[model samples]
Target: MQLEKDSKLELNDRSRQIGDVITDVESKVRKKYETHFQEQEDKIAELQRQLNLVSARSRRPKRGRKGKEV
Candidate 1:
């Protein structure tokens, strides 16, 4: 009976350790994904800004039929 109790305790301890490891791994993975998403969002925002600047610079004033400013 004593040996059986000891075995059970050891198994419980190992299970707890595994659970802790899983939790830690999950936390790390979530942090990594969050960082990657934030980087992608920053890149997209920068590209949008650049596109707006380019489009704004490409606009031209309209002219009349004689080529004079309307």
Candidate 2:
């Protein structure tokens, strides 16, 4: 009857609201994780660059005393 129809409509509205809230929360979580991953990647890249510079410098001979003629 009419009462049953009204109940169904109310249930549908509540379900829709719950779905919207879930979607919003999921979007926020994804954004936070994406930012965290990007920061980690940037840190790794910076560390790699510093390691390369140190390795390159170490491979070269010293200039003043080491390079002097015997």
Per-residue lDDT of model 2, residues 1-70, tens digit only = 0123345567777677678778888999999999999999999999999999999998887677778634
**Ten contiguous residues minimizing lDDT sum, candidate 1:** 1-10
Which 10-residue window in model 2 sums to the lowest lDDT?
1-10
Instruction: Give the whole-model CA lDDT for all candidates, comma-separated.
Output: 0.80, 0.80
Q: Tell me model 2's lDDT, rounded to 2 decimals.
A: 0.80
Model 1 per-residue lDDT tens digits across residues 1-70: 0123345567777677678778888999999999999999999999999999988877866679999977
Q: Tell me, by TM-score, which candidate is best.
A: 2
